[model samples]
Target: MMTQMMDILGPIMVITAIGFLLGRSSIGFETRTLSTVVILVATPALIFNTLTSLDITPETIGTMSSAALLCIAISGALGLLVLVMARSSVRSFLPPIMLPNSGNMGLPLVLLAFGPEGLQLGVAYFFVVSVVQHSVGLSIYAGGLQLATIARQPLLYSVAAVLLVTWTDMPVPNIVMVTTEMLSGMMIPAMLLLLGTSLATLKVTDLRPALLIAVSRLGLGILSAVFVIAFLDLDGLTAGVVFLLATMPTAIVNYVYAERFQHNPRQVAGSVVTSTLVTFVCLPLLVWTALGISERGSGADAQLSQAMTRTETSLGATYTND
Candidate 1:
């Protein structure tokens, strides 16, 4: 399982290498602009397409929602811990710490790594994380909340697009779907290119803090999974989904938020860059090691026994009459 995970991480590492090297070569100017377009237009379409394609039953929706909230809760806890440890106020420390780059980097990779299941989990991550970041993250980072900003968000567009697909069997306009797809297809590579551009701008001395941030996320992530996932009875693809999303580095949204609200945008940006780079290796490891097929815990064994008993039942009297 570990070897298989390493195989999957190889492409990610290659892509990341290209990103970093391109930036290092100072040829990433065009790539940065292309990345902006991908984030503002294409990536959202891809996410909407994936989310709408899902057959979100009430049970599945509940599970997704629950998992997302759990993730948000953990994120909040971690951010607060960091702020306190640094002797920084919650109002100044959280926005940079809480939100992760789920959209620009996480969505596309998740689709590739874990397929539809992984994509769905990414969408779930987007929903919960976005809501929490906009609300709780903003309040903490700014020392106040703003309801109007939430009320006026463009995110409703995604929700509308998703519902349009899910509730109807009608065919989508060919041109529209194709355009959306083209945009969506551009998202991953463009994001990597932009990341490359960013990396090129940083000096070696500037990267020490980034390294520390990455190690912090990875180490804390390991601890969080040890307790939360084992207690939750999630297994197989679901377990993989949870761990993959949970282990993602501080999101790019934090950078955006920091422009307006955070005390140290540089630190936030550093964390985002560092964590994302490391997650390429760490994400696959976490999924395969912590989330793959596993025996359900103690109580689950009883449930399995009951299910087997039910499966064994039959209307036939067998040969007892003989």
Candidate 2:
């Protein structure tokens, strides 16, 4: 089990480590742009496809979605508490502090490690966090968002997907499913490669603050989620996924917002790299323990867990793409 996990985790961490290195280098901007493109386009398609393609059951989706929402609520609240206690206001720092680096880095890494199961969990995380980031976090960050910013959305599409499944005897189209799957499959590795390109340009010393802030934020978020997961008695995968997503580094969307609004991009960037590096170690351990890996698990269980994990990646991609 440890060996299998190490295999999955090692490459993911290595890519990010490489990314960090590249990001500090002279070629950083060009690499960052390409990474952004992959995340904005290829990754979203992967998410949509995986989310839609899996044999999605109401119970499964419900459990996963609920976990995600719970994590977001917890993370968001924690961030606010930090802001408040530090005598900071949401207007100044809450949004960047609250939002995790879920896209570009999180999406790609989840795809490679958790497969379909990870994909599903990642999408749920994205949906809930996206909302929190835009609504509560955004309101705090921007003073107020224009109705136009809020209006541009696919809220109804998510609603219709659920309703379509509930209201009638219909199936998702095969062609659409295949197309999404193909495109989504390309999302992770491509993004990682681009991340590598980005990292090749940056130096390590300049990014220490980003790491420090990310570690602090992620540490608090994970501690909060761990308490909730224990209180709720979630399933192994559910519990692990919840903790994993909660531990996601500060997300890029917040950084962009920070950049646009004249918030501190340095803090946001530091958190992204720091949280990411920490997540690689923390997540696998959390999963191993939460999933009963040492107790309810044996060799067979690892294999079974592996299968379940794959569903998260594959189905999540479908659901997101569709």
State TM-scores per candidate.
0.74, 0.73
Q: Across residues 115-173, which tens digit of lDDT does each residue of candidate 2 receive? A: 66766766666655665665666565567765666554444255346446534546777
Q: Tens-digit lDDT track for model 1 on 70-113?
A: 66566668756875776654554455444555665566566666
lDDT of 2: 0.57
Which candidate number has the best lDDT? 1
Candidate 2 C-alpha error for residue 26, in Å: 5.8
Q: Alpha carbon lDDT of residue 138, candidate 2?
A: 57
Of candidate 1, the 10-residue stretch with the lowest lDDT total is 311-320
What ranges in model 1 sit over 4 Å off?
Answer: 1-3, 28-32, 54-58, 146-153, 164-175, 202-216, 220-233, 277-284, 290-322
